[model samples]
Target: MDMGIEINTRFGRLGINTTDALIDIKSRMPVVEARSKPPRVRIDTQHVQVSIDQKQCFAEVGLKPADVFAKEMAQKSRSKGLKAIADIARKGDTLARVDKNPNAIPALAKGVMGKRLDYTVAALPRSRPRVSFSGGVDINWDMGYVQLRAATSRPEITATRAGVDVYILQKAAVDIKYTRDGFDTTI
Candidate 1:
């Protein structure tokens, strides 16, 4: 009971007539678009300095130069890793061109948005702690939250970096039909 129209073009010769009936089609469909957030890095120093209203005297506590170096290395690793991921995601999105090539959509979903985006950590120096990007979708889309964070059970500082996200919108479509005298179309 499936029916369709066949139109001929330079690619090949074809024919369409009343026997080949056009079936019900979409007036509109959802198109997906993506926006990316900039990569980020963070550090938490567990010390707070207090100051008086008028004046305050500063005091020094024990310092660990190695810890400072480690922090810098960790931040650098995270920032660079995220930046690389964002670039890859951008490339994948561009290649997908979801509006034009539907076939590329699945590749974009699996390669850029999945664990592949988190590959930078494997090459980072040992001083940096591992980070992971976990994804989730919500039935109520507005309530969804996506983020990146440390991969440890007990992280001193919880970090969140926003990555690219895709959403959909409906668009109008055109319908075509033929009459005995001529053709009619509506948008």
Candidate 2:
């Protein structure tokens, strides 16, 4: 009989692992905003004014007493002189005849007629009516105006981006095994 030996063996294979790359992006849209304030205004005004004066008018128009009496006396004296002259002319009398007449000449003024005569006259006081006027006025004025103001504001925006990452999920492994076979003889 012939004897024989056999051997069995197995080899493990290497394993590979892979993962896909990842990327992330974040963004914000551009924004536009506007704001405004209403205009502010103010105004001012002044009233009209006036003034008048009349003192001077009163002083000029007023009248006093003694002036009236003097005017009356002058008119009376003129009339008396005219009457005496007319009587003498109507009678056809000469100055010599008048001197001779006892009734015509007064004892107190007999010699004084041919000479200068002087006399003093007195008058009474009284008020008279008169017309007068005066007037004056003053005026003032002021102008008005307005004031105004305004304001405004601007807009804002933001954006962001993230990085990519890659990693393995499992590791590769290998295993080896061997077995031997032999023939046996018995006594």
Top lDDT: which candidate number? 1
Q: What is the lDDT of residue 64 in candidate 2?
A: 21
lDDT of 2 by residue, 21-119 (tens): 445444455444545454544444344344434333433444324565567667878888887687567454545577677665563355445666698
Estimated TM-score per prediction?
A: 0.19, 0.24
- Evaluate residue 34 in candidate 1 and report its C-alpha lDDT on the 0 to 100 scale: 49
lDDT of 1 by residue, 101-143 (tens): 7667666667656673343334222243334344333232233
**Whole-model lDDT per candidate:** 0.49, 0.48
Q: How many clashes (backbone N, Cα, C below 3 Å) per candidate? A: 0, 0
What candidate 1 gets wrong by more than 4 Å, as runs, is 1-65, 74-78, 81-85, 88-96, 112-187
The 10-residue segment with the lowest total lDDT in model 2:
122-131
